[model samples]
Target chain A: MIPVLGGSGPVIPSFGSGSSCEQNNGWWCTDWLREHWGDTLQPALVQHIELVAIAIAAGFLIASVLAIAGFRYRLLDVPVGGFADFLYTIPSIALFQLLVPFTGLTVLTVEIALTSYTLFVLYRNMVAGLRGVPEDALEAARGMGLTRVQTFFRVELPLASPAVLAGLRIATVSTVSIATVAAFVVPKGLGEPIFIGLDQNLFKTEILAAGGLAILLALAADVALAWFARAVTPWSRA
Target chain B: MSVLADQFTAHTFVDAFRFIGDNASLMLSKTGQTCELAFAALGIALALALPLGLWLGHRHRGLFLALGVSTLGRALPIIVLIAFGLTVLGVGFWNNTAALVVLGIPPILTNAYFAVDGADRDAVEAARGMGLTERQVLLRIELPLGLPLIVAGVRISAVFVIASATIAAIAGGGGLGDIIVNQASYGLAGVIAGSLCVSAVALLTALALGLVHRAVSRSTTARA
Candidate 1:
């Protein structure tokens, strides 16, 4: 049966449940889902997750370094962040199309586009978090004769943990949802079934059902990321 | 290749500018398309959200949960919604616009909710005591007071909606996305031209929203 919070469904479990797009012949919305997507589903899900995971990892790492650079240089903040915002507005599909000539339309295009998105949200949030760090905390850390790197790791990072985590939360959830859109380019993942259903237009129930699952996936990722943030940084909590 | 790379960058800039100059009609059409979407969505959001915001902000029902939910809406990437919409609505301008509107709603809702509701309750009571109708209270009192925050939210929403609308171009609804996507097939000049046009429109829309926001807020301040 389809798992749902309400009776509403787009059963996520059966990503590759059936071939019949029409004639509820082999595909009951419930039956299609009950079949358990098995091997086909698992690899698709893994690849989707990997694409997002790598992109977010790259984004966070690059942004953290750039944030530090922004803090040090200040000028880098405006131009770099502005550029990120510009990239943020570029349609991911359009960007993917742009990259195809060079990269040949693979996971790289998806990763780059998704990763670029994380930069805008993460850069803005991380910068805000770093700026919001209590000034006196840093003063005390510096007074202890800590080197710049040591001070950043020990003082700046710890105190700024909440904002950074908030950034990560935004980044993670956005990554989860945006990752599915990568299906437009890649053949694998939860999105493929939904797109596949659309391409065939055989099963409205199938497409809607699969799509509903992706939405649920997005919501779950958002909630989990928020919880992860709370767990990582207790000081930011109520 | 190295020498050509530098020339390409400069050449792309020139070509991009020329595209804007040549295809100003297309640029304007896409810009208008985006504007229409953002403004219509903002108006719809305000109609639903303003009153609810007043209640949430003023009443003590633990609005954090609601605010948190709206934040989640914001965090959900725009493209996911687009993909989902394309599947359900089967792709077109209206479907994409509808998706953008859904994406646009939460920010305005949360902002209006917070701004209007956060008004001084004592002031609300006084207005009521002075025989103000609910309409008067909202119009003459709470709304005027909350207008700044509400407008700020709209501004924020406008910025995002404009950006999201560009991606909506992939739906082939005839916006800047048309230019950007056709870049490769259309020639290098076309690609450079399209991207610059999209960026320019996105930036200009943001700037125009900011101006309108400032003007309205200023008028409110002057009236006060």
Candidate 2:
């Protein structure tokens, strides 16, 4: 029976074995991974990466355009922020349920929701970075006879790289995490194994392996973006 | 698009509203549970984060520790944490609350550290010049000045916790998620109703906290 909000009787807590992957005999069995790796982990990882990349790339493009336009029309600021905030407030499961009926549990459905989540983080930071360009720096660019276009590309954008990249780092890491929920809509990613393992009582190995991989993916993405940010903003180091 | 449109049809709208009315008590109870879960987690987080954050911020020590905690907090997915809690610690309120408290800590700690550490140097120097004791300066001066951003941090954590409490339903922790996940049996109307309730609660919480944050910041600035 579905547990109603005010159901009668005390709710019983279910227990699963308390085992760590490092100490557990389950995940430590190389034979188990070897058997499952080809069909399970590899494809799931690939799909996970694909979903994250598409969402982040699309989010970045949309946020960049919106941020640029926001600079032109100050009126866009509050509405854009409000819309993003509204989207951010929606629960992930509710979001998936709402979209699935329309988009039919496809990657597009997942991407739409995922991309929307990124807008709040990306748009806010990008705008802040753009607006944060020093007035003196702008004056110098104008004094040097740089056109509005040249100054934007050469001065404003480069100066804003740190903030924008920080946003990108945040968006990318979060995307990796939220993308796990994609397993509910479509049979893809580490989430598939994790959820399946949970439902089937397949022990700690599947859950640990998939969850650990997702965490590792987030860490790796964050580090890579940090390195990229440093590479692009060499003057910050100077 | 049709499905989205279908959801707002007069029949569905009536059904949704009626469902909400019929389940009003249950809805309120569930919302209460979600609120309890969030506040309990927040309380635990504040207890741990406040002292640590204040001490470090006051001493200006362990900037790296602050950064490291924030990074780990972001990188650790809540779902993953819940899954770990369920499997490792066994499914109960304690495990679920532990996971949420972990989720709530980073923002509180990071913002508190930033607030106290970044308090106006000149004002702090003046306080010191007046022969104010360290404890007095922190309690009387720094705490009041840092209150706004600290509240802002709590606002962030609060919103996050409220929205995330829905997931607690999955682990037998009871929230609106129980209704949400059972949409198959209750029909789309029930799902929509639950979704609306969750959204309303989350948005209202955020709005309320945001107002408080604004009020605090405004008063703090007015004093300055």
Candidate 3:
């Protein structure tokens, strides 16, 4: 996702990522991070959160719309689903390069990429969620003289809520991990810290430390998401 | 036909041939590299994770957690692992292969654990009541019962590992990904050739695994 478009570098959130303390404070890659690890943590964590938040918000809304359309009309499923599959097949790096011209390497670019990813897994889950509504329930709602819209809101959505939440949890964890790549283009977040560590080609220990932290963040996200999933669905025990 | 269209069509075909000719030797070695990485990782995954998985299934029934955790590997993309591994351990085949193994482990481990745990609990009890030791029960009843699931998981893991191993080639892991990346700069021919290499490895491994799965599953099914 190296920036190749016309404009500023990646659309990282408001955070100072470009400055290097190596020269000013002789932090080098290694000790610089150690000396000011707290300084790096805020920006990286912020960037990470921003990337994930943007991605999930966009993805779920779009996926929900698509799911509704698909549920209403079966014919739209193949064409739209096929296209989503196509997006999923293309490597993340290649897709980013192609979009750089339009999105200009910002949070928007990363958001779109991460959102597209969520589609592959989340769309299926969304379909499953919607399809899971019992037909008898729908018929009962119909017999009660409820409109299609009302049935969907009351009978369908509530029944599908757990499945949708499960899908959201999966999408959340997936987005958090995938969002790391946004740092390849953008200027903010933990990715920048890790990328800078990789790029400067200095501070081996410091880079390793960053790497360890990234993995830790990844594990933490997994646990938190698992907790969230369990909270939403008491039946889905590990 | 317009000469431009004809020439373009001819160019695509010729480019395809030339790409294959140019990378024939490189393709073979690269294929070997990917195969070696996939197979070795499969072996290691089986050795390290399979027994543990089976044990978890049999003992306190912790395999479910193993299955849940392994799902993490599947959720994350292999490309990211390749990228991260390159930075962490410099760039080379060993590191790439190691990363592939790490990526490959979850599926195999999950399958092994579940298959063993899901083995006919009745038969397991029968074997136990017959005065069989835990090890004997596992070796004779559990292993044989769980063989199908374990094999199926291995097959799936093998295919995934092979496909993923291509990305490792980017970091000089010496596989089809090298071809994919190499010819990618060359245009359509490079893309086709590299794609072919990846597809070949994936499909071939998948087919082999399928055969293995069928044999193992059939035996287990017959026993049941």
Candidate 1 lDDT, A32-111, residue by residue in tens: 55564664445666676788789989999999989988978888899999899888766565565555555555777678
Which of candidates 2 and 3 is the stronger one according to TM-score?
2
lDDT of 2 by residue, A1-238 (tens): 9666876777765544333432453634565567778888889889999999999999999999999988768899889988988888777776777776667768898899989999989999999999999999999999999999999999999988888999999889878988887786788887887787667554566777788888899889998988888888887751
Decoy 2 TM-score against native: 0.88
lDDT of 2 at B94: 82
Pairwise lDDT winner, candidates 1 and 2:
2
Who wins the TM-score comparison? Answer: 2
All candidates: TM-score: 0.79, 0.88, 0.69
DockQ (0 to 1) for model 2 = 0.32
> Which regions of candidate 2 fall more than 4 Å away from where they truly are?
A1-31, B1-18, B215-224
**lDDT score for candidate 3 against the true structure:** 0.68
Mind giving the per-residue lDDT tens digits that candidate 3 earns over B185-204? 55545545555665566666
Docking quality level of the chain pair in candidate 2: acceptable
Q: Is the docking of candidate 3 incorrect, acceptable, medium or high quality?
A: incorrect
The Cα error of candidate 2 at residue B142, in Å, is: 2.9
Indicate the TM-score of model 1.
Answer: 0.79
lDDT (tens digit, per residue) of candidate 1 on B102-221: 777777778877777777788889999999987778777787777778777776676667666766755555666665656544455665566666566667767786788778778877
Candidate 1: what lDDT?
A: 0.69
Clashes of 3: 9
